[model samples]
Target: MKKIDRNNLKTFKDFLIVEGEKVNIVFSTAKYDRSFNRNNDEGLKNIESLKVDFNVNEVVYLHQIHSDNVFVFNNNAKEFIEREGDAIVTNKENVIIGAFTADCVPVVLVDEVEGVIAAIHSGWKGTFNSITKKSIEKMIQEYGTRIENIKVYIGPHIRQCCYEVSEELKERFLDKTKIDENELFNGRNLSMERCILEDLRSLKIEEDNIYTINLCTYCEEEIKLFSYRKSVGTYGRLFTFAYKK
Candidate 1:
């Protein structure tokens, strides 16, 4: 459990050392762009950083669609082409799982014993579709991963402190939630992020299995993150990933 502040953004690193496995979950701050076709400058730098500790060639990244589609890389890409998916899981060692986000929640999951990891991009659409549950189900069904042993690291995104939405949107969120939403926000809450976590909880995930990084990309947009809502335009994306070798 460690937080790294770089380029004015909060990058999370979850190191896993067990059974001869060296796995890590790394997240990018909003300062990086999400729409990279190849390994952009920031992406290259991030990959290089990870390579210093892992295999750079084994890293995999997705072309993040807001939808719930997930893709598992076989390390068969020509250069670094982005795909149209929101999640990726792999049991292969040295294969990295990467996702992009600016204000959206970028989630990373790891099953220590099985040595399987997933990198996810959980946007409003993804959360509404329950991408966490989908990813967990995929792990269990496709990779023989035990849900109880899953450790989910929720990376930095727009926090509730500044995640204010209209009353109508809030009500729509509340309508979908079974838990009391009254105390979720001090004065506001990030409905999308909260929803994703609840979705995982509903899937029988333990409370301790979930970890959240309380960094707000919107407010800290100029500091170290790239915020779509704050940026007011389409631009680069952050490089958030989970790599194991």
Candidate 2:
């Protein structure tokens, strides 16, 4: 896969390609706030710029509630509004589906063979509930996506270096993921990456097919990514999306 790194966005080419058809996996930086709730003129203008930049007909974003619900968009005319779920999957073309996040993990899953794509907003709750596995299962059941053919991309988020959680939360995550506490924890700081990797590997997803950007959203400065922890709950969200052409 080819990676195009820019000042405000990161694009992965060929990661979701099939038979010369290409899909762009984009992760926006803080410079481009793509929050879905913004209704100001500037917000509309920003969305318009995104449309022009990606050459997509529509942009479907989620109303994330930190749940494990995965909504499937089948291109129905009435399903045009913001979907209420933490993950979204679709097989339609020309519509870019995205998830909004500040400190939560932004994941994009692509079944290159089936031409199916999914976006997941996985926080502690979503991760504990095995949202990624559910989304993959949904794709397999609904869109004929095979586990072996799926490619996973994990974007920037709060990592273990600074993600200090309570003892109860840490224990719950450890129990759910069944990861060794020593490997998944640095003191009270839990490694979301390790838990996610363990869960993915348990589903028999190949390690090579999984790609992680490995940037910590809470402390990164180069790209100026928004971090919920860093901003104390008042922060602009970063938009990560996948668009196929």
Candidate 3:
């Protein structure tokens, strides 16, 4: 993924592009807080402006309760706003589907062959419940997308270097996912990236097809993104969206 000159949104330049298909993965910085939970009017207006700026037909997002729910959006469905879910999958063109996050893992999946895309927000709760796995399953079940055709992009989030969790939560994640303790946990710190990658691998997604931004929301040196864990009082959200047209 490459950051545009504006720096507010980052787009994938050479990944997931196919003949007659325009696929874009957008990653928002701290400047664009597209969270509708507070002051919905401004947020909705910003979304409208984003559609014009990004050249997308529509923007769809969810309320993001940190659950494993994946909302499938077809072309015939109504405009989506503040629907309760943690992920979104769509096969329609020019429609941007996304998930909001502040330090939580933001993942964008695309299958150029099938013209399918998904955006997922997998926090500690969502990861434990296998949200990414469920999102891919939804795409396969609904759109007949092949697991091998999908390309996964794991965006910026709070890394294990600064993400310290309690013993109870750590143990639960280990026991539930059966992920290697050494790979996922460094003493008491947990790697949300590892959990997400492991889940994708279990579904036979090739490692070469996966690209990780590797920018830590808590400690990125170049750009400072929003982080709920490191914020003093108020924190903005980073929007991660995928578009296929």
Candidate 4:
């Protein structure tokens, strides 16, 4: 776990977490707009405030096709790439990687020894495709990072109690992977949190090293966490970002 720094936030927020020499976690607790929720300046400002003092290389994001395609940012090619994908890993200390979500989980990874970090978007579709495992695999292959030294954070999002899905979605999970029948749909597995935990345990991410926010975006209006389902389609996005200082 990282120490709490009350001075870094730009507003009244208890959503961000800073850890040791290698990692920081930012959890956004609100939706900034109503029309398709396109306005996210507030969240961006809050995210940027945490970046102060970091070398800050190119930040990474994806169109988030909700697949298992994980990219490694070893070279400068992605600097100009505009396409969206599910995951991104970087070896550069200054590079910050982030992913946006209103309800999806922001799965952050850091290679403590190598200073490599990844910000991942794990919607239900991505989890079915094994996005988490793939990101860990990409880091090891591209940066020689060890899964043991990597610090993992599963930030706030929709939790399982509120994540119940329809019969169609439940069936979809059964058809996709080896995941247990209990994890899926409208109020099922809760997408990001449970799936990330499953991946960590499966990949040996260790229960001790994994940290979670355990927040259900849909349940809390007081904290301001975004909830697409709660907002009934019109919801603004919140960002999850990390950079080296």
**Winning model by lDDT:** 3
User: What overall lDDT, based on C-alpha atoms, would model 4 receive against the true structure?
Assistant: 0.67
Name the 10 consecutive residues with the lowest summed lDDT in model 4.
30-39
lDDT of all predictions: 0.68, 0.76, 0.78, 0.67
Candidate 1 residue-wise lDDT, 90-193, digit = tens: 88776666776778888888888787888888887787678878988888888799878888877767777777777776666677675467654444464566
State TM-scores per candidate.
0.78, 0.87, 0.87, 0.79
lDDT of 1: 0.68
Predicted candidate 3 versus true structure: per-residue lDDT over 44-151, tens digit per residue: 676666677668888888777889989888654354555788999988888878777788999988988888889999999998888999999999999999988988
lDDT of 4 by residue, 1-245 (tens): 33223344344243455545656555554544321221356544554554453445455566667777787766564552356687888766666677778777778887778878888888888776778788888888888888789888776677776777767777777666556665533444435455566667788876667766656778965456767888798647766767665
Residue 67 error, candidate 4, Å:
1.9
Over 4 Å off, model 4: 1-15, 31-58, 75-81, 175-192
When summed lDDT is taken over every stretch of 10 residues in candidate 1, the lowest stretch is 11-20
**Evaluation by lDDT, superior candidate among 2 and 4:** 2
What is the TM-score (0 to 1) of candidate 2?
0.87
* Model 2 segments more than 4 A misplaced: 1-21, 32-45, 76-80
Each prediction's RMSD to truth: 4.8, 4.0, 4.2, 4.4
